[model samples]
Target: MGPSTSAPRPRSCGAPSAGVMIPHKTKRGEAALARLKTYEGVPPPYDKTKRLVIPDALKVLRLQPGHKYCLLGELSKEVGWNYHDTIRELEEKRKEKAKVAYERRKQLAKLRLKAEATAEEKLGSQLDILTPIKY
Candidate 1:
């Protein structure tokens, strides 16, 4: 509210005379602390890795074929359309599918083993139950 400047606002604490420094031991302060969360000594609502599908990202890039898409400001345009989270999500999906496939294979192996054991047991008992059927 002082003067408009091009630079971003700097962090400043409340004035001691304004009674803004509420004691942390108070219930109101505890409630306020519960409402706020910090990570890495920073407040919540942090910038994080956003998830986006590759195809959808491609569509976004194609929609605005001018703005240069950069990833973490480190890698350049080497990746097609700079689809960051899309490839990651796809890889995760692939791994999930593989894991499910492995689990199914394991279950099938167990079922097959059980079936084989049961069949062997029935065959061994068949000779005793159905002796030579004489006419």
Candidate 2:
């Protein structure tokens, strides 16, 4: 056989750690960390705000020479979290919402056109009645 053509796999880093990695020495700090809620996507309140990026957490900056590393998302998938499925579900919901809004706008436009046609017919009839016919 010739040389192996398979790509090198990332090194296993053992079991994943749970919860946020905040330094909490005091009881109050622990309580505050516990009280903080984590959101999956950006919330409506922060939608307009600019997102902050940590330079240290960036892939290019954190990567070492000749070392392969697996991302946290990849590790989560190995732990049985269906990240792709969740994203698919969210996309479906968003499409459904847009479809419903489009349908509502179509119905409103139809109603508006019908109302305009009825008004024009009523005005034409009144004008015919007011004008006298030449014998």
Candidate 3:
């Protein structure tokens, strides 16, 4: 049999090479990818002081902490990203984080309440029944 020749699949480029190991997303991340691809369109004009609009792809990528640089939205224009996609990404992350926080709170509350109960309380109260025996 002839040896099969095929090109190796390319791993996600932007993912970190060291530190925390975030596995390559296979399916759920597809939506984000699609959004990233669609973010090539231009975003509307935005005031630098208030709302800095950027394209969706740039927003999805993890950004550096701080810089004295100009509003990133303006810079993103040169890179071909726009603002509406940026808003979409922000909304997605906001909802995702809120849901996770809510679930975590619910779990912690459940654990704390369960721990506060005594063994007897957890088992329920005991009731005595009297039976008469005939001789």
Every candidate's lDDT? 0.50, 0.59, 0.45
Per-residue CA lDDT of model 2 for 1-135, tens digit only, reads 135533221122222122235556678767766666544433456543545799988877878878977665456456554554675566577667667877998999999999978877887867576558523
lDDT head-to-head 1 vs 3, winner: 1
Show model 2 residue runs off by greater than 4 Å: 1-20, 88-135
Order of the predicted models by lDDT, top scorer first: 2, 1, 3
Stretches > 4 Å off in candidate 3:
1-81, 119-135
Which ranges of candidate 1 are over 4 A from the true structure? 1-81, 125-135
lDDT comparing candidate 2 with the true structure: 0.59
Question: What is the per-residue lDDT of model 3 for residues 54-96, given as tens digits with 9 covering 90 to 100?
Answer: 6754734545567444544444445444443666576576667
Best by TM-score: 2
lDDT of 1 by residue, 28-130 (tens): 8766655543222122232222334677647565667786654321242242224335545665766676678779989999999999788778789675665
Assess candidate 1 and give its TM-score to the true structure. Answer: 0.34
RMSD of each: 15.8, 14.5, 17.3
Q: Residue 91: error of model 3 in Å?
A: 1.2
Question: Which candidate achieves the best lDDT against the true structure?
Answer: 2
